[model samples]
Target: MKFKTAFAAAAALTLATAANAQVGPEVGATVYGPEGNTVGTIEAMQDGVVVVNTGTYTAPVPANAFGEGPEGPIVSVTKDQLNAMMAEQEKQMIAARDAALIENATVLTADGVEIGTVTSIDGDNAIVTLEDGPVSLMRDQFATNETGALIVLATKDQLMAALNGGSVEGGEAMEADAE
Candidate 1:
């Protein structure tokens, strides 16, 4: 009984150690850009982007700024090498976005202005049905593109209001869309 207990404990320890050994990108990992420049040391990864310590250049590059490395002394990487690393990261992002699961979401302008909810997206052609009726401030229009993901960024209520030619006011609605 003593031997069996001891064996179980040992087995558990081994399994725990193995699980802990799985490797992931570490804080302070070297980051490179598209042109192989040493961008900085990774500080954090959040919201699908990489934050790095500022050295010669600004940090917090999108996760698309890193790549597999020869794992070495962290601080010695040069600017060009870092750029190369980031280039690799960007390629991966493009590939992943291309293969992203097709689902309905809201669309925003490049400047993050709320546009409309995606009615349907077929390949690069996204049908963004207008949310509000034409607003004087913002144009109600559809966008179509190739090799880009259509992002939806609004709620059904917002869409309905917009379609009815209503405007969002200071924490209230100026005009209500017809029900």
Candidate 2:
């Protein structure tokens, strides 16, 4: 019957579409660092390693290097590793583009300090604003969730100085000016 044929055709199309859903590395996926900082974006995949270009560097890493982020999923990679891969001219352009194109990034310090969240990222650095508690920190220093607490990355002296209302030269004053 015509109805039966139409139904079968529709079903086949649906199945085919589902089967064609793209998987594996995709552009705009979040790339992470070993310490959990969003290092860069996925430029490409080669030889089982995901090539991440973090603007400053491009490196090939294991498939597990990436995870999810607010803008998208974050993958993991490192600067040194990326540099080594740069020897091959084929991957240079994409890697650099991927590195430079990253707009959002999870930021942190080298020692795993839970600094305030990064508002944005650019080549070689990011703009981080002070956030207020135990800010969740990834091992790589990018990507964190404050949840219910105010995220902070100040040292004991710094916090005491802040609470006590002190000023550092050049930096903005901590407390609001009295009315």
Candidate 3:
């Protein structure tokens, strides 16, 4: 697989405490860098990862990458560094996604569950034929995982819910379109 490492290495031991002090960074809590500079705020916790909102972008760091500090939870990368890394990662991810998005290709969820088949591609949109029917989705929504498997950055249930709720732009449930 040609996937670049998706995770930042675990934060330095000095910055992280055991198990983030038996808990993890709470949402809205400020995250610090090793030098005690503000990196960002914890926006969410999902699947053992913490989403740190750096204003410019959100970076997904493993929960274990955080350590308790005198002021708050600390991560290894400074604000600027993390933001730059995230930007680079985003470019790489988009490139990988474009490479994998071929007609007839099977798309998988981030956790590796096959979600649908790519029936066609039009400009920046793709039509994936799910169980119900075809749904149009933006190409930006697709990316490859650490194993280079073509996947979206959501769980199967989340994608299904979005399709069912008609929340994804240009995505209409196949059955709903018939009605």
Which number leads on lDDT? 3
Per-residue lDDT of model 3, residues 107-177, tens digit only:
89866899889888889888888888888877777888887877866668767767676443354332212
Those runs of model 3 whose alpha carbons end farther than 4 Å from true positions after fitting are: 1-26, 45-48, 67-70, 109-116, 130-133, 152-165, 168-179
lDDT of 1 by residue, 61-139 (tens): 5554345545521233466655566667656755654443233555554334556554444555444545533222111
Model 1: number of backbone collisions: 28
Which tens-of-lDDT digit does each residue in 35-104 have in candidate 2? 5666677788766687777786666667755544445555444545555556554355434433432333
Worst 10 residues of 3 by lDDT: 170-179
The lDDT for every candidate, in the order shown, is: 0.49, 0.49, 0.81
| Model 2 alpha-carbon drift over 4 Å, by segment | 1-24, 28-37, 75-179
Backbone clashes for every candidate come to: 28, 27, 2
Deviation from truth (RMSD, Å), model 1: 11.5
Per-model TM-score on C-alpha atoms: 0.29, 0.26, 0.61
Q: Comparing candidate 2 with candidate 3, which one achieves the higher TM-score? A: 3
